[model samples]
Target: MEQLLASDALSDSGKIMLGGAVVGLIFGYCAQQSRFCLRSACIEFWGGQLGPKLAVWLAVFGTALLATQALLANGGLNPQDVRQLATVGSLSGAIVGGLLFGVGMILARGCASRLLVLSATGNARALIAGLVVTVAAQASLSGVLSPLREALNRLWVVGPSTRDMAQHLPDGTGLALGVGCVALAGALAWRNRVAVRTTATAAGVGLAVGLGWAFTAALSRVSFEPVTVGSVTFTGPSADTLMALIVRPDVVPSFGIGLVPGVFAGSLAATLVHREFRLQGFDAGTGTVRYLVGAVLMGFGGMAAGGCAVGAGVTGGSVLSLTAWVALLSMWIGAGAAGLLLERAEAIGRRETAQL
Candidate 1:
């Protein structure tokens, strides 16, 4: 990284953006191939059918935890300066925003990352929903919804000292947690009979996340200009990428700016190679209103929570952030609740149709 920065080929920001694009590409390809999605995992867990979807999610999560912890343990990465640990956080925002994001993913049938992958495969529904999510996220960030987000964020706050879970735990606790998660993931994958290739691919998603952190951290250490150290995230990045294209075409390139298009291009390549490219649109089973509302919820909720599924749930969780863990648990609770409600509603509708 230092050598690349020393070269006059590209600017410092450009190098960071290129690094992000590489990580995003790997993430996109692996996620698409493995069908890795938190929404599907949530549904599988809540529905009492811990099938392939849950297995895949665990593979990604456990691997991510293991790899990230390994990097930190080896002194290859220092996340003290990362936003999740360095800044004040909101417990109320994590709880409320997590719940909203969980429910929104259910209604939308995908999270931010999933929507982007599907859009690349020519899913018009996902394309539309993704756009709405971007708009909503932008609004939450600096537009109409900012005031509400700020209010909720102020309801409960925690300082940086208390934010990092490692501070309160034993020295080896992070490694222990990572190992335990990996073991559980392995057991689940074995029990579910997930294919070897699929499980490996899912693990690649986690590895890509670790690589994202490593790349940024390494660059930050050597670069003259300040650079944020973060991994794979979609909510804020999606909004930033969209705004850069529309409102400020000349906006300075950043990691987030490159990540969005990189994911799309990677997913597109995967679909093309796998012969999964197909144009799709909304149908009666997939109501348009539900998706629009869900996108709005996800946008506001993700911002309030300080991250989305992959953002707070995986990346921040890997670093053992208190609020990130809280948000993840809240997301699970919300997803489970929303799943049951939807099932009951569908059952009632079926009964009514039968009676008629």
Candidate 2:
């Protein structure tokens, strides 16, 4: 385990990634079973119903911040080089990206991670989203959208690794900060869960996500290759995983299940345990055009802004990356807009049906 985090060996990185994949598997299974999703909670939870699934996400964000900070402070990893810090802030990317993502998720009926896990359970909608995202992501990553995304990246003020505070902060402070934030997020989540009376379930959900991330971080540190303690996020990694599947299938598996495969694996594992996996994506009732349009936004926005809500919201948020904060906050605005619109549409339809 100690050898896993060593900078001297590439094998360590692979070990860390493998460990991460295991943690991800657990996360996927647990998440699938629990149906944990911030957006789902936010979008689906009604008054006097389930509480916002914010805790699971908050736990992930909080833990990612604290643990990664501790690792960097202790000289276990280089925060500067981590992709989280490498991003150049892009307001347009974050906002436009988020709005597009928010809309797409609504139409697709889930976010990227949700799509992955759900697809495994036989939800064809998710499978469609996954396929569309992969193609759009490729375009955004290295195709027609590449130049546009680069232009946006260059537009931002490249901070001197404000993304690397864990490296600068004392190990103790960073550790306490990391642990404390998780604690804070936990408290808030607990209060919400209790309020909603889903205490037991929420705790389990939050625990699975937090522990999964922590486990991965520990594994990444001990593994040989370049490792950074991290957890779930669906934007870049999902895209990379998708592209890699086609381009470099043999490239060493790093930290987590690459996006394309992980979605199926995690969802399948969930389905088998629960016996709920079924193929779901062909509804003529819901416009495919609407879904595809939304997906395009997610891919382009994810690339331009550096991540989607899951990537920025949960994963990057875990690191407390300022940019992640920007992205998440922006996403809420977009999500709220879309959610509100959907609510209005539903209300109008109900009224019309009543009159008829």
Candidate 3:
């Protein structure tokens, strides 16, 4: 009875975890229902059909930027002190790592977050891929592969790092945010004019992403314990959650850690509600091999780049960090290059078959 009672009680860390879980739940539902995928976004842009989905992407960045800035202005958080707010690596690292990640993403057919959603919705391949990602991320972060990651990190000249946009562009932070907000709004109005379910879902996701930053920031400010202020990003948190579950660490679960499983649960609930739950797995050995390779690459590349699509593409990009922007562009170019190569190979194969 005593053991049961004790287990039922929630600690301060547990409370924070609960809040993070709620945030993740919203994100998962919105993402699943809306079919949000950074890979799809990139593909659409390449195909010249960048419409509603692209608008949603812009909206996420715009909303996150505005909301985060509001938190900063209202004393909800201190950007300089927050560990996650800082950009870690140099330009060379960002470009190279992002290129690798983008290529890996194409091979995987999804990004980190997408894998989680697919896993919850009965995709066995995504589950395996997720496990691989967790293991590889851990290896790169602190396990045997740490040495390789460190070596690559050291390849470039270590320079001064900036915390966030406000600090980086002290004089033009407001202007930057304003310009970004206007552009995103204009895009949504002009290109995504139709008010569909996807639009609402996108808006919800944008708000949730912003709220994620605010929620973490607010809690970190009042809590006696240390916490990281961040929005959504799946790479590091996948490893963190896996460690917490298997290793039973001394520390309480952070927002990112809690959000990891929450996303799965939320995605599961959403799929169930929508009656879209279906078991999916690799149809052949080649599919298994492809997913494994992609997962490993994404894990290492994401760590090297300091983020995945959401981390650098949405979260960091929203903050107007130059490193994030550079990484995002590199990812775009890499995905485009891979796509073109694949197309050319297919065309060549078709031509050869015709000759035969």
Q: How does candidate 2 score on lDDT?
A: 0.62
- Estimate, for each residue in 1-356, the C-alpha lDDT of model 3 and write its tens digit: 12221343665477567767887898888888877777777787787876765666665556666765666677665666544455355566677778878887777888888898889999988888888888888898999888887777677633335535456567657546745764765566477673566666755666677777777776666666776678787889888888887898574677787788888988899999999999987785446777888888788877877788877777776655666677788888877777777678879989999999
State residue 140's C-alpha deviation in candidate 3, in Å. Answer: 1.0
Candidate 1: pairs in clash: none
Better of 1 and 2 by TM-score: 1
Best by lDDT: 1
Q: Please give the lDDT score at residue 51 for candidate 2.
A: 43
Candidate with the larger lDDT of 1 and 2: 1
Give the CA lDDT, 0 to 100, for residue 172 in model 2. 67
Worst 10 residues of 2 by lDDT: 194-203
User: Model 2 off-target regions past 4 Å?
Assistant: 1-17, 44-52, 72-75, 161-231, 247-253, 256-260, 350-356
Per-model CA lDDT versus the true structure: 0.89, 0.62, 0.73
Candidate 3 whole-model C-alpha lDDT, 0 to 1? 0.73
RMSD values, in order shown:
1.3, 4.6, 4.4
Checking candidate 3 for backbone clashes, the offending pairs are none
Instruction: Please give the lDDT score for candidate 1.
Output: 0.89
1-356: candidate 2 lDDT, tens digit per residue: 34444445555545655555655665576667656665665564332233446555555455555655555566555554456665556655665666667666776667777777777787776778777876787798889888987776666544646653444555466457657756765676666653433333334433444444555556544544455555566666776676667888576565544433544576588689778866666677777887777677777766766676667766665555666667677666666677788779989999999999
Report, for all candidates in order, the number of backbone clashes: 0, 23, 0
Give candidate 3 regions above 4 Å deviation: 1-9, 84-88, 157-163, 168-195, 249-251
